[model samples]
Target: MNEKQFDKIKNGKGFIAALDQSGGSTPKALAAYGVQEDAYANEDEMFNLVHDMRTRIITSPAFDSKYILGAILFEQTMDREIEGMYTADYLAEKKEIVPFLKVDKGLAEEANGVQLMKPITNLDELLKRANERHIFGTKMRSVIKEPNEEGIRAIVDQQFEVGKQIIAAGLIPIIEPEVDINSSGKKECEQLLKKEILKHLDQLQDTENVMLKLTIPTEANVYKELIDHPRVVRVVALSGGYSTVIANEKLKENEGLIASFSRALSQDLNANQTDEEFNDTLEKAVQSIYEASI
Candidate 1:
């Protein structure tokens, strides 16, 4: 682990930028960026287009370490290049931003009101490559749709189980158990999630630590205990379908949770915009999230 990067994540005054949209999410992300379905003929071409999109965002002046502490990258992005350097290398060495890789293979079909992560085949190989490419950590996600204790317990158990593997491979894991905001019992879901998470956290050894990326709870500061947990490095909040403005408002209401936003962060950017316009829009988004984080 990189001590400097760890310090930055633990004490930095900025938010993480979630640019880690994968194969399943690339189309929607591109559509929002003004690229249509007809823009690419095949999956490879589609990935190329999305890579170019990510490249633009990474190279933009507004997307640096000033208001951004870290960036989460898709596996492909970590493998690709940006301005003649590998993407993760560029982010860490030149841009001074910590780089994280999204390591999950998407989610499984919902069962018991939760969607657990699909099995990650050859995870050790992926983690080795991420470390070789200068990545600082890894993020994996599972989703909760309701407050089923059995389902939530399973999700957290799966996360910590995989997290231990990541730790063995010398990377911090950001375990995300997202609660669907539109669910009928959102608050109950968060409450159950918190309980499950604390139970798992208690089992970790002194040398082991992990980050938590949670949905912004329906009740502000409900995660205060998690934020102060000795085993937790930092607690971040995902945008989770909320608009940027609303996400920011709720984020400010929570004292310590910081933002790790994807759609909300890039919603204002369109491929049709000129360089000046794109940068201006990104500046505003970064500034708002940064202010809310601090």
Candidate 2:
């Protein structure tokens, strides 16, 4: 990325909204928000929705010109040839939009008296998929851990290894060490999480243009402390597992540039309006965060 590009992202005040329209049934609430029911039925509909959403966000005045729109591609969306072609076509058509590829197989779980995460056990497969995504004008965004030391190490290692491959392939990697709100408590937990995250960053010898996804600390003081870290290039606040309204309010109250919001936006979709309405609401929500940041 060039200096101009870096500044645009660093100074921009908005969140990167994610719609997991990959496989699971589209929520009824989201269907009511104008999302096509068929969109979630197959990969074709999902890809179209991705393109439609991107175009809508970029063209909207609510989202700043410098802000970036990211789409999350899941396992179901990337499994077939037709869906991949659609994704590539959409990405090629919109070269400027930042596309993110989700790498984790699934959520982490506890087993055998040890916290375990579904790791990207196949490095070659991951590389191949990432290369395909690159061909479609999208970069890779991998989530490393949920909220544990072991999980964090696994994520950092994967990021370090994948970062090398992605850079060699001429792509950007969005490194995320997501802290689970379920395991998080007050200020002390936030501090420990920040410390662990920073430790991981320190271990990345050649890491470049890395982004951190963290739950917005419940305490403003902790949030400020974490944001002030010198090693943290960009901070994208997580929307927590809550409503977009609440997430938007938190983003508004917090001081951060990029917000990674997924579940809230997807859960709000209603089928009453057209695709345009769904996109409009998303843009509005993002703009609310941008304005709040300013």
Candidate 3:
């Protein structure tokens, strides 16, 4: 590991504060939009879009100033070996940017009052892949499913095991526990989510060099509560489902320090927006945060 580089990441509160205001929304959303059932038909177009989006982001003021922007890679999007190679190459070229690998296959569905567990059972394969990613000059992050106490415990155990493997291989691990809000009211959900997060972090003590990627609660106070946790070292807010613009605005409002935005920029790319337009919007957004902090 580059101690100097790692130190830069560890000491970057202002940079993270800027990133919290903008980064993750573009990649996750774009992956969701581009990798639909028939998306493979337009592989070239999708790859180009990803390439353009990456370039635009890295050139933004945030990247230049050393903000830690994280991105997650979904299996659906990189199912092919060549696709995975491309992603690794792209990420390796931009080693300063944090690139996360999404391991949970998908959301577990509730059936007849019973929630199913969506575990990435192939631990060796996942770790092997993450190791390959490290060789290419970037670290990895994974997402754990939100389930009942038993399920959550299982998820935490699995993640700790994975974290150990990641550290042995010299990679950073991000433990992302996604809070489900579909069935519960927003305020109630946020409170419960906070409790769950605290519980998970406590269990994660044995894991070294770990960060938390949490979903921003719908309630403002709930967001504040989670952000205020003394044990919380780093917080990367999710862009949530489909609403990238709204997500970006909300992240900024909540003082979230990092974002993995994908959807909003994908829309702009699909609409054939010019590079200038995309760059201008990102610059303005980042500038707003920078100026506000000053």
Candidate 4:
């Protein structure tokens, strides 16, 4: 990634508001919002629900303007016009919040008992779209479901390879190697993922800067070493499935690491709330995550 572009996102309050939920994720969110069971029956319906959720989120006072530096958006909603303006355009125009796209097609079939993201096809074309939309970066996911070093290595290899391509197209890449927090041997998986990440990162040219979005490791300050690496623009932690309270607690101990949380950020929000309650709820979530970043 270009250091200049990376700097804008890495500095300040380095919190990413991840609103890029896929079809599978939408149903769960709808259930939490107490949407009727019929709402989850069709893909189109799911997108509509997700779109409405995005409307509430983007319009909320806490989003795109508070301690957030950027947002990672689902493809369908990235340039989507809400009211009379595009979501990305609205954020940039009003809040100075950067926008990023989620590019990978989701997980592939498990390899050696671990899951990796499917490569993005026509990625150059997608980057062209992102550039056109004024999005500054991209995020893709791969999960370490098991503690196999070889498997994690494969995942990181693919991430770095795709990441280089993203940089070539002038967008920053947030390489996510998420470890399943509830799985057996979580700490071991974290160690394996970290080691494999270093393998790809150490081999990159000095001019290429990459950002990491890893699951929170069991040990606090475990990622400080990565932050010190010159090639790494910033090291960010995902909340995974942790409650906001627990996520914030773990995040506070890790100096130099910021949050890129999705669920934890929205866990308390619901369509049932009044505007005042919704804004207050979102503000508290933002404040907690923001304080952890500092």
lDDT (10s digit) by residue, model 2, range 1-294:
334435544555445555444333334323544665655776566555654543443344443444444445544444433323544334334434344566555545543212333555764576576566543212233332234445455555655565555545544555554545565333444565566656666665564445566666666535565466654456776666757777667666676545777666445444454567766775666556555445
lDDT of 3 by residue, 1-294 (tens): 545445544445432321111123334535543433244345466555555445455445444353333345543323323323544445435445444455544435653222433565775677567555542112223333333455544444555566556666666655565554353444544454456556655654443465555565565535555455554445666554536556666666565445544333334433245567656666655454333222
Each prediction's Cα lDDT score? 0.94, 0.51, 0.47, 0.83
lDDT of 4 by residue, 105-206 (tens): 989988864788876887988899988887888899988888887898888888999999988887889899888888788888887777777778788887
What is candidate 1's lDDT per residue for 1-294, written digit by digit as tens? 899999999988899999999999999999999999999999999999999999999999999798999999999999999999999989998899999999999999999999999999979899889888989999999999988999999999999999999999989999999999899999999999999899988989998999999999899999999999998989999999999999999999999899999998999999999999999999999999999888
Query: Considering every candidate listed, which one attains the maximal lDDT?
Result: 1
Ranking by TM-score: 1, 4, 2, 3
Model 2 scores a C-alpha lDDT of: 0.51
lDDT sort, best first: 1, 4, 2, 3
Superposed Cα RMSD, model 2: 5.2
lDDT at position 254, candidate 3: 62
TM-scores of all candidate predictions against the true structure: 0.99, 0.68, 0.63, 0.94
Can you tell me which runs of candidate 3 are displaced by over 4 Å? 13-68, 74-95, 111-117, 135-169, 180-183, 221-232, 242-245, 253-257, 264-266, 282-294
**TM-score, model 2 to reference:** 0.68
What value does the lDDT take at residue 155 in candidate 4? Answer: 89
Q: What is the Å distance of residue 267 in model 4 from its true position? A: 0.8
Name the candidate, 2 or 3, with the larger lDDT value.
Answer: 2
Backbone clashes per model, in order?
A: 0, 11, 15, 0
